[model samples]
Target: MAIGKLFIGRKVRDIRQANGATQAQFADMVGISTSYLNQIENNQRPVSASVLLSLAEKFGIDITELSSGQNDRLLSALTEALSDPLFETYSPSLQELKLVTQNAPGFAHALIAAHQAYRRGNEQLASLDDRLGAAPSQEVTPYDEVRDFFHFVDNYIHDLDLAAEQLATELKLGEGENYAALSGHLEAKHGVRVVRGEAGDEAIRRFDPVGRILTVSRYASAPTRDFQIAIQIAQLAAATKIDQVLKQANFRSEEAVEICRMGLYNYFAGALILPYRSFLTAARDLRHDIELLAARFEASLEQVCHRLSTLQRPGLKGVPIFFARIDRAGNITKRHSAARLQFARFGAACPLWNAHQAFETPGRIIRQTAETPDGVRYLCIATQVSKGSAGFRAANPRYALALGCEISYAGAFVYADDLDLSNRGAFDPIGISCRICERIKCTSRAVPPLKRKLVVDHRVRNPMPYEID
Candidate 1:
């Protein structure tokens, strides 16, 4: 049997095409023969160490990434090209095509690039609208929807704290006993089997809706287990609210609506586990110490950080924050925050941020102050968390989560009180909006923003143009 080579040859080919480099050019740059590079791209030959190392060095990427597959690879380019809202209206097969693109990455790039082009074209048209004096389009951008969600969360404080306290009191989940007790309670009430499976058992938890039972993995940490319970509780308790919010959104597709609903359910789950008011008080009292909050709320450090970002429940807001979780290769896995951060939507994140450094110092909260090109400064707190399977046979790996907020709100918490903000020694300069930023001088930019149109000029004074193409 042939070995399933780990390198994504399709993706590598797409990247080369995107860069406008001929195969010969790339091969020459990597110090390899063109025929050998062709074989690698065609999947007939595995990427050599020398070639992989050269590519990683040039791209400032990890060699491990060049050899492995992503957990959640996006859809392929051709699928994205074929995926029109019009197709979903007429043919259900288009949906299957989309799923194929999502799972099979050769199609992912086509979809992503196509969508990027589609968005850019619309943006250009919108720019022309101002001159024509036409009314703006009523269509809602995904960015606007996300922004509105955060805006609503920033002010809308719910009664989740009271609910959590009451549930804890009623269930006697506090001053915690063994996880087995919770497991037994679940079994008795919901028919769930809290069996300890090997980590990386493929399915960490399986909810049999028909059986009205869930099989949870024993490899989960106490906090992870509690989070699972909280999710179940949220699904049961807040189904109505979740449905209502999703229905009101008028999502373009059923899949989008379902995705949003699941996201909201998870939000509610986090709120249930770490009730807002009490969590806020602890965060303030402990000076934003993550370990203290983790112990107090019986949550993982990453969970607390994620919950802190959502403190934007309108009216009684905590701090406006920005959150991003990235691996060593700068691939962002989970990101949700209220702050105006500039990040590449479909590619790698910026390299200068201190979030990556958190992996070097696991569990300990690291803080840094960053200044955007707009002169806005933010206080970024980041840390690494453990990642692995919950079952004995599981092949779980580790991951990291990095979160931060504006420096103005840092005083509301105590994590960095003794650190001298006046000194500016600990703080590094960074930008939030990477696309719209005109700071062409930045050496760390992985890819140019989608907004900037490239122009080929034979007689241009400068090599790069800031103006739209």
Candidate 2:
């Protein structure tokens, strides 16, 4: 196997600039000549191992920070952006994209911004026919706008995570004491009463601001109850911090700000349940076992999976995972990805993904070696999780949670232990959505690709009604 070159000249330059050190000063500190450092910073030379060690020893910087796989993320984003039908014939090769991401990251980000603007414009144009005679309207949904904000930020709010971690420490929440700590904090700090009662069939938690009472449903699991209490604590204690982050986001509408506030609260809750440093260390030590981690942290499987995707905290980053929750109807209820695989913003997910099959085998985890149309392979695990059972006659609310990481990191995941990673035939090919998928002969395809022509023949009927050209 050929070891890839570590081209971290830009990162080194960035670190030097952040510390307000001149190139000559940094080069001397790294024990490299100024000319050589200049060449390295400009991508003309690869970073040397000696220089990496010197910088680590002198500056107390993590070596991984200099070689973070941000280029891979940029390459994935660029590839996804170019896969749009608008650029069907102008796609760049993987190598070309890597070069752009490595050498000119700003340009790559500019291209992604342009593509996003184009998509927004195209969406507006598609809705033009519905408002032909009416006055022009600017009625974009704030929910979607906020979702895009979180999606673009990779679902990790550094400030909020740190704040929640601090709050958890202040509450002295140790392992298995998350619920008690949060409930006690709420009662003592805010003079609020925490009670569990028969919330109406649909209500999971209800808070009376004036009465300062937080009511949680008795039907909820212990983890859910803890998470609800944490959310209430966030609203009461961290509202100003949440508002600060929302203002930094500069959302267009008040509705977007409100939605983002709730998202930040939930983020705080997740952080409280799984403090970043401890959770990441535990996850690595346990080979990223969701069930074991949930048991250890007193959290639900869904919460663990969601927290896994938000572990992108700069120098202390963890594996980049993608997580999604879908209903039995195949509708994606929640989704986030720190990996290359992105879920479709609209419509149901591809039928071939094991996430859809999770509903059939409730409580049993299913492992899959799946490949996307982009040619990226992932080790995916899926299972059904449920909450809130009303009674013997009422069905609980259930959703399938799918968690995955790139195949390169599969060795660290227990779910991939018995899989044949080397055999190409073992991986199942999947797509983001039927409308955007380019697979011509997929038997499960519900619709033809957007820009491709179709061939229909009455005498030549196969699994699909029409053949894509």
Candidate 3:
């Protein structure tokens, strides 16, 4: 892996100030000269290896805390936000962006948040006339809020994951018997009864605390029944730990807190069913073959793919993966990334992505080696998944699941074995969203890039109506 230069001046300064350390004192503590420390704090000099180690050891912080991943994420977000048409006249240079991101990160993040609010408002009022003149509401939906909270954390909760693993081990919840073990645990530990309801019921599961009855739908698949049991286990047996994590989250609204609570409960359930060590071992041994691993763990395909993205357990980190589920309309209903690729937070995914093609060929894993505008290449594997409505007359929900990793790590995946990854020409060009994508001459582009000009030359005909400037 290539290590990027660390420009964490603001973070270092904040830490020093928070500890009430003066410049000279902090320099002495880190065994650096005051002048060098000042330069480092101002982003004039990158943090040296010695200084980074000293900061981690002397301050008792994780070494990864000083990594440049957060800086890259913030920079990427700020750049994407600036590409909005609302900031057309304010085109800052790359160096200017770097400076703001490295020095004034808080302001940069705030500006990006404001622009996102404006964009959301514009989208909400897109059908109304004079929408451009109206001010955007400064609010974010609870679902989006909770989703971003998980997304930004790389979809990993180390402490909660460890707790789930411990619980699973203590309960001796072996493979193929998760549902029974979990049901027994609920009854023995929390005076709860697990029962299956009629197949006609639409709800997947319902809980009645007063009656101490947990009713699961008979229509659910075996894996789903087991998953629901684990979820209830988290809600009851892991309530104290869940409460602790919720307190740490400090969500703004009660609704967001509840949503985050549910997310955490689901996360715990995944960790419990697919305990970290065993799952990681199986994944590696199977070369990350989703179907094989799913069979081994008795988990759903989506569950397996989703769990792969959350294997960022510090020293025991697995391959960084990006997982997303898109409906037939190209709407991303579920998304998480431990890779460099971040999905579009608004609107549909790029039409060129192989994930969309999964809808065309159901049940088969579609493969594509795609290159984004940023030049990052990925080995993408996608397949369509559907749920039976349990009745002929009802509608069944279907989605395409996309799971991928950076090209550099493609060797670890079973899906990439047949691909010509080294042949750059074989990669398809894709983008995040058409509005901010800089892919010129793309036939599937729904709209022009927000920050680019167009040349309409009627005399010289081309595939596209207008040539992008």
Candidate 4:
């Protein structure tokens, strides 16, 4: 296989500027000529392997970090965006797209932003007449800005993760008394009290900042209570660390900043409850068994699954897993992937995926070896999880959690032991979505692919698609 050139002009410039070094000085440090460094910074030339080695040896940069993260994800998203039906006239080559993603990422981002605005604009235009209002240009939502921040970082906040891991050691959460430690710390250090709310209250956590009280719902589960306490402690004790990250994020809207802030705090809580070093050790020792890990950590099934996807701590990485939570309607509410498989960002997931079928068995974990259109096989598993309600009248949301990694790592997962991983027939075919899927024949396909040609045959007298080009 031919290796694609790695053009990280922006990243290279960022490194040099961060170290407060002149172009000539930085060029000398990286064992490159000043003119060659200028070309690399301008994206006129690709960074060579020698320069990559020098980057590691001279400045202690992680070459692997540069190879992945934003570049790979951005390229994937950009390709998906271009596959929209609206771009019927323009068909840019994969090489061209790669160049755009690598050399001029800002332009690539702007193009994607325009496409997102176009998508939102169409939705607004459809509802304008019925609502008796004119269609207005929609700016990108703060939620999307925050989601992008998390996505580009591959769902790992290193500084916050290390800090939370340290705090967990200090609080002795590994002793299995997580709730007591978090609550005591909240009260003793931050003048905050954790109290149970009234019986009929529907709110999960209601805080009075002035009164320094964190009131959690009475009907909430033990895991939820402990989680809420951790969230409070995260905000109070880790404010400085959170701010340092927020400053680097540089979100345009205050809403995005706060949303990202809460995301970081939530991350801190998860890290504290399940400290990285100990949790990773436990996960490996148990062969990545979700239920066993949940039992050992005293956490919920969903929490354990989500934590498994975030073990990307540089050199000591865990399995490259993808995690998602979906509702009965197939709406994916929470998702992250360290694996190569990218979840559909638009509509629902592929109907053929086992996640949708999980609602039938409820508590049972359904496992399968599934192959995507890209020919990447993954060992996937899904199970249903429901939150308890305050009462019969209150809403008790139920969601299905799906977790998986590449088929090669199946040996490390207990769930894959019973599967016939060697047989090609055992792998079920799946796609991101019907509209983007290139599968030629599928009964579950809701619509023909936007970019493919179709031929209908009425003489067959069947409700099946004749031929998908």
Expressed as tens digits, the lDDT of each residue in 1-469 for candidate 4 is 1124777887899999999999999998888899999998877888898898899888878776666656767787787889998898998997678778877888988888888888888888888878666656678889988887888788999999999999999998968577888899899999999999997677889899999999998888888899989999898889999999999998988999999999998999999999999999999999999999988888899989999999989877788789999999888989888887887667779999999989999889999799998788999999999988677777778999999988989999999887888998889999988878888778898878888888888777445646775
Best-to-worst order by lDDT is: 4, 3, 2, 1
In model 1, the Cα lDDT at residue 451 comes to 39
Go through the candidates in order and give each one's C-alpha lDDT: 0.60, 0.83, 0.85, 0.87
Give the candidate number with the greatest TM-score.
3
Q: Which stretches of candidate 4 lie over 4 Å from their true place?
A: 1-67
Candidate 2 structure, TM-score to reference: 0.84
Measured by TM-score, how close is model 4 to the native structure?
Answer: 0.88
Compare the candidates by lDDT and give the number of the best one.
Answer: 4
Give the per-residue lDDT of model 1 (tens digit) for 333-410.
Answer: 766656545344544655677787888897677777777665667777777776754456555555667777667667
lDDT of 2 by residue, 210-242 (tens): 999998888888889999999998888788888
In terms of lDDT, model 4 sits at 0.87
Question: Relative to the unseen true structure, what is the C-alpha lDDT of residue 161 in candidate 4, on a scale of 0 to 100?
Answer: 96
* Candidate 2 residue 57 C-alpha distance from true site, Å: 5.0
lDDT (Cα, 0-100) at 468 in candidate 1: 37
lDDT agreement of model 1 with the native: 0.60
Model 2, residue 348: what's the lDDT?
Answer: 71
How many clashing residue pairs are found in candidate 2? 0
Instruction: Give TM-scores for every candidate, taking all chains together and pairing residue i with residue i.
Output: 0.60, 0.84, 0.89, 0.88
Predict model 2's lDDT versus the native: 0.83
